[model samples]
Target chain A: MSAPAVAYPDHLRARVDDYLRTLRFPSRAPRTDGLEDAMRYSLLAGGKRIRPVLALATAEAAGVDAPDVLALAASLELIHTYSLIHDDLPAMDDDDLRRGRPTCHVKFGEDVAILAGDALYAEAFQHLLTAQPGEPARLLAAARELAAATGVDGMVGGQFLDVAGVSDTPEDLRRLHALKTGRLIGASVVCVLLLAGVDDEAVVRWRGFAGELGVLFQIVDDILDVTGTDEGLGKPQGSDERHGKRTYVTEYGLQGARSMAAECHRAARDTLSVVAPAGATELEQITDFIFTRTS
Target chain B: MSAPAVAYPDHLRARVDDYLRTLRFPSRAPRTDGLEDAMRYSLLAGGKRIRPVLALATAEAAGVDAPDVLALAASLELIHTYSLIHDDLPAMDDDDLRRGRPTCHVKFGEDVAILAGDALYAEAFQHLLTAQPGEPARLLAAARELAAATGVDGMVGGQFLDVAGVSDTPEDLRRLHALKTGRLIGASVVCVLLLAGVDDEAVVRWRGFAGELGVLFQIVDDILDVTGTDEGLGKPQGSDERHGKRTYVTEYGLQGARSMAAECHRAARDTLSVVAPAGATELEQITDFIFTRTS
Candidate 1:
């Protein structure tokens, strides 16, 4: 299942940004009007492109040209972006702002926002179909991974449980955030593996890395919500407390949660050294990006 | 591409009903409590199971046993049922009842109903993973077909266009419904073709058959909505007129719409005759069932 090291060469920042700007989503209906506009509003609105960069880096680390998986890589961001849109729905989180801009529902209206999210979800899978016929097996594997990550067991289920306010304790909070925040990030890594033709044993090791990274990502987010200000967040700070939701910070206290985040981030870097290629510094950088981002 | 006269043996009524009763959805989330129940409420609360039976009958007509594509066939129903649940949302059609029972949002809260629809949509694709691993190409082919059909160029695009009320005349209506209603129905036929390992030429012919069948199904729906009673529809009649949405029935009078439905039925039956095997009578019967059934 292992492969000889071919160090990842590129940063992937430029390549991922270029792909998102250029890729044309396949739409046959003629009256696209504002549908495309609504989708692009959030999709292209600039959120650091962390998810796709993770996928692209993973592909590059596995000794494949990241551009070959560019469409597949960008799809992770689309799914992530769509989840954010749906989560901001008036009926859901009721968030009126995100990414330093108006939320999708606020910008495009709730109906269009919902439809945009649904469109993005379906298009994420549809875009993968453009993978060349020679890569059918790997393509199928990636698509399946994406679905399982975003579907009921992952993002959707996590949102459902979160909105129902079903958690009672720290363990419940850990389990909830693991599914809610963890799965798609895990999927982004797995998409890279399958697309790069990595083996299941290697995939298992990378999943361990992604699991730690995902929790680290969420914990940092909770830390940001508590410590950052509206000027930095583009929304009010202390939102978790406002909603009376128990995040990692709330459960662990500021100092304890910071330690937990650091521990998880360290575990991820350690695992990366094992699963990644020799001199695969890009992945480690991305791990730090998820761990240290303030907004 | 022409198949001989093999009739679609067995009514498929009992088999499809039995399969729907017994098939287990692939859901991993533990706190399924209300989400699963809402999905089942609309799903198991019976309709004719028309779409799935089409896939099965198509499989059977191609000379394989129907159960071979059971997962694929059942997936079509899941998708169809999910679309119905979404369509009946208060922000959408706002129907209170369906099939003589409460609509999902009416029975469940709007939030849960939305979640249920989202769950069903994801589960539809997840269920396809159960298809034969031995036939990776066919399985991938089926999944891709479903995704494309319900995706931007197909169902999702159609729904967006519909809600925006983009149609100006009859041709616009046909184009709208072709995407909205046609693609999934078309995917049902394509599923049977790929699963049967049929060639491309046969697939084209069956797609034509499905195109006609999809329109026939919709025209019949509009007519039933205009003329049927609450006892038959399980919801208030005159929904299309109440909404003032354009339809075949609205675009053409009742007599004209009925003739259009019959014409579509004949065209579908005619195309099926060329595409079906020597004794494929069951498909013709199903076509008639779609046409003549009042409910």
Candidate 2:
């Protein structure tokens, strides 16, 4: 019977899309220059909304209602979207396709794309500060975590190392992914923990799970780059190798990388089993999906 | 006696520089990739430290000690520095020189420069959230104001309009500058008001003065771009005209722009006189310096 045919929380994603569609700018320019349109172009473009989904799942696992942290969750997607826009710039990964459409820079021109990314970054913090439902301290703490994960020592630092050429050793590649992609993914969960006032013991366990999930996600991504087709991936396959960038698949053989991903998946599920075994069904499903996603 | 010698607030600038130099990252990657150095290279390169100085001066005018708001004040400079790095990119203004040295992209490569700018943007919020001294509500308010001013309707929107080619009319030019340079400059003062718990009446007055000061600063900058030398301005003069960009001098003519700057200076001083007559000596001096600055 196909295991009763459950779904991956498209309802939560729809809620996010609704809130984002109705987002009202506190101020706007008298002259229109397509900045807002450009921002919404990539932001509203279809993706899995994985970061925000992670945030909502973390909230659910912690026994908080999803709507209570919806804005916080959506803010992660803003940061993620901004990173994608900037990453696709000609000077960076230089890809022309995202989500089966022209990349932000390709569609809107480079200057607008850069500004759109920047505006989204600023909007992420603004929306978190203004729209989140929490006490001031909790909100501030969440903002701090988001900023730290997005900053120099996190995603930006990781990208720098990647562009500058890491040594392709497992350690360097791990560090690169941990910074470039892992920190923000970890933050998506940790931010919910901060907002929900989760206890420290569970927080630590969740942190471990989040770290493992991040590694797992990156490893699966690397594997799919080798195995997936362009139509399935929504981007050109093997572009990573073309750019001479290091990945887990490059550092370790494909089978080796898949083994590592499976190990991480195991560690994550085990950690979750100990922490929120009763409430983390969605988190478990999401983990399985991330590990096995074809795209 | 040559009018008792006094200087601009080099002491406050020194304080900001010291705080910035000692900033500690909460997390870091195992590999170093020149991102930190790129951020520092642009941030520490001197440009009169006007934005932070404005913040500190606002704090002083409100009868608050500068050290209490030093981190908040310095955060503005970080945002300003990030904007400059991004603005000087080859896809943007395409400038190679800034503050009498190679631009961030020229010094650190384009990819590193982009990441450095991104890192600085993230760092600005992180520093404000973690390092700024205030109650949670107050700090959150300051952060919201900062983020709003730096986002789409503010600096980023203004830059978008500028790059996309405004109509070069006086209204369009005014709107562009108001968004691009004016919003963040205004936020520098208003952030202090929020942090210090200043009343609404005084906040409105300060906002007006800040608006005038921003216009004055941009007018003087436009004048200098037309009139100053490479050595004096620390960047190539006439580059705006060479790029076919419109400025205050282009829209209003040199004499007309100068007159407008003088009017703004007078309006700013008048606004300050009504609100902070006794405590705003530094504010008055800075206003004069901005109106008359050669660079």
Candidate 3:
């Protein structure tokens, strides 16, 4: 059975939505071709603004109300959108739908979709150079963190391992999730710390918290894959089963996955308490929302 | 008739070759599944190593004997390798041969080939964050230059336009080449100026020089496609004709294209004189190589 839907707090969600609506693009003569349009089509497709939200909440928790990092946050989403575009390619997962619309390749040709994804990756880095919440050094650190998370030993490595079908042991499974999803989610939090120029020790503690949150996200996602309908997923249901891909639910069973997510959520909250103590209300609430998101 | 094979400077070739041999891998347990091997396979596959040579030459021309930027130079090759890998994808050019050998997708399978390209991109940026020849600020500038040159208004955009067959005018042709190849070549020189902390005005001058060289490279390439044969060219000749792709030779005729390349080469040498009046023997030689090469 699925848990009741969690209400993500309205204030943070509103800010992210507003920012996404009015996102600035480089001022240049628009191409007659549809490359830029294809980029915008997928970028503006709505989804849970989870990564950006985590960035803002982490910044606030670190005792800074900086918003310059929103550009960084937005760039993060661009990178995320690119990953989705490529991962859905006919050569990859071969998905037909994403975020309730035809995938980029379905809407555009496969060639245009590939270029769109490639352009976004480049754009994300281009934007990162200019987006600084505090000092330029902080921005530089954020860029480094994002690059590391996106590269081998992080998202790309994990994806390679997944496509290789090498995860037989529980340890391999954990390593895969930690690299594939955990690094980027953790980067969202790390960007906030860098924006605030927090202490190294604090960055360490927050990473510990964020790592658990990332695992919690995958565990919940696995559970939802088993429990979710096509409507809730915004794509085909039972994709993991159909593809025969391994997941937390598959390894631990449905109830076991649920229990593991609960354990992780509790552990993540504890680390947050250690790092922020008097703050992190938003972070705490966001943790629960991760467990409860239907799509 | 093809020009005699211009002797590539043995000294520069040796340096790049020595650097590529036993290139360092980040310390980690090697994945047994051959993802790393795929990345290395494409990376070390012999090409001319032109981009790295350009970077090092530009740095030296800027009055810095800075070998430290070799890491940055090396990362430039990584990006170039990635572009080659993707451009050969089954969905893209679908080529089976590159540099007289099987392409990445042909040897590694399409899936790993895709991941290898993606990972190389990420790894390039990750490596860039550490590859400062001067100070951090200069490094930041270098990073920005690289990112912009790679993004929508640069290589990827030009590629989109090329694939879309959008260039019909001379203006469109110039824009296509400038974005596709010129910006990155321009970046190699720009990176050197940044590394040596050269003034902004100098950067503009060097870029003008590099931009002309980039055009010369392409003009000669189109000439080779028309005039050279399968053995000399390595890949099958007349690919542009077979694919019905547009080129300078197609638009201007062989003699006309040769005159244009000579003009650009002369213009580039003039700019090089202004920026590095005391030196640039290699730069001048390479400019001739771009114009006179048979393969």
Candidate 4:
């Protein structure tokens, strides 16, 4: 049985929503055309701004001002948005629905959609460079984290492996998830740690915690695809099974997958316990909330 | 008529060729998945290697050692290669031929091509970080320059404008080329200035000179696409015209475009005259070489 839904503090939820709103592209002149529209449509489409929220919340939990973390948070959102746009392309996942609306390609032409995604991905760094006046070193560090997590050795590499073939073992599923979904989510938390000037030991602990949390999140996502209604998922259900895509739950029986998820949550909690510095009550609450998300 | 072809210095040409060969990915075991083969194929499908050559030659002209500039030079090639891969994708330019060979997507499957391009782009930063043991700050600056040139306000943005409409006026075409092809090439020259630790005033002047040279180079390319023979051009001539793409040669007639190209080249030479320090004969050679290229 799952734990009851945790009531996220209203203030934090509102903050995330507001940030998402601010991320939309400013409207260009009438003749400027569909590129900006496609970018805004996908970026501003309602989804749980979880990754950016994690970055912001983690930074705040580490005692940095929330505004100081805003640009980094936005950069995370841009990376996430780019991935979604690309994944939904005709050459890739080719999905019609994303966040309960037509995907970027479905709404705009394929060529425009591709360019929009590329623009957003590039704009992420442009925004970072100009976002807030900070140490150039810190800004570069943030840019590196964003690039490394999204580029070849991170999410893209995992996608390649997933498309090529999955290893037959359950352990292979774990390793794949550790790269595909885990790295970027892990980077979100780590970005906050670096921004807050956390010690190396604490960063390691936080990254480990986030890694486990990411795996748990992926497993939960797989489970939801199998069991949840279309309305609940905001997209088609059973996509993993339909596509014959290898997933954690596919390798492990339902009961086994559930048990593994529980283990991951426990490991995550344990790692978080090690990393949470003094006065980290909010961080603890956020971890608890992660364990309770249903979709 | 174009100016007579100036003989390029034998040593510089040989060094560039050697650098290109050494930069090819080794087809060793554990990496024999054929992805490296695809990357190597594209990297070796030689164009002028203008960008990397500019980087290395500028550094040398600024009195920086060749060894210190190798990684930076190679990083520019990696970026150029990655951009070519994406530009040739079905959704983008859809060109079957690049540099007289089947484009990356034609030789490699689209999925592998996408991943290969991604790997090259990511490897660019990895190479910069690891290859040169120079000041970390310099490495970071180089990476940032590359990123800015490729990002939204740069090449990506220009591509966006290109695909979104041909409704652009002559002025819009100029702006688009400045970003699309000009930015990265400009960044290539700027990287050497920054790496050589040139004074701010000198760096500023070189950047302006490089930007003008890039625009001049692109305008000449547009003219060549329309006027040059298929044998000389490698790819089919007038492909851009067939696509209804608005180019300088499209907006202005052939004669007008040729005159504009010459004017741009002259302006570029003037800028270089102001920026190139004493004893920089190689820089003058590059200016002449740009004007004489048939393809």
Q: What is the DockQ of each candidate?
A: 0.49, 0.72, 0.57, 0.37
Model 1 lDDT, full chain set: 0.79
Candidate 2 CAPRI level: medium
> How do the predictions measure up, each by TM-score?
0.93, 0.96, 0.96, 0.91
TM-score, cand. 2: 0.96
Which residue segments of model 3 deviate by more than 4 Å? Answer: A24-33, B1-4, B24-33
Backbone clashes in model 3, listed as residue pairs: none
Error of 2 at A162 (Å): 1.2
Worst 10 residues of 2 chain A by lDDT: A1-10
TM-score of chain B of 3: 0.94
Estimate how well candidate 1 is docked, as a DockQ score: 0.49
Candidate 2 lDDT over residue span A31-144, tens digit each: 654888888899889787888988888888888898899899878998999999999999999999998999999999998899999999999999999999998999999999
lDDT for each residue of candidate 4 in A203-273, tens digit (9 for 90 to 100): 88788888888888888888777877777777898888877888767878677777877888888778776
Alpha-carbon RMSD, each predicted model: 5.0, 2.5, 1.9, 3.1
Residue-by-residue lDDT tens digits, candidate 4, B1-295? 3666675554665676687688644211122246567777888787777887787778777888776788877878888898888888898888888888899989877867776776677667656655755564565666667777876657766777777764467767777777778888898888777766677888888888888888788878888898788877777899898878998787888788778878877887788777764656766677667766777
The collision pairs in model 4 are: none
User: Which runs in model 4 stand beyond 4 Å of their true positions?
Assistant: A23-33, A277-279, B1-3, B9-37, B129-142, B197-200
Please identify which of the two predictions, 1 or 3, would achieve the higher DockQ against the true structure.
Answer: 3
Model 1 ranges with Cα > 4 A deviation: A1-11, A132-134, B1-11, B23-29, B132-134
lDDT of 3 by residue, A1-295 (tens): 3668776755776777777677544413245247888888898888878888888888777777737577777878888888889888888788898877999999998888888888888888887785554565776788889988887777878777777888888888888888888999999999888867888988998899999999999998888878888888888888787778999988999999888988998898888888887967888889888977877
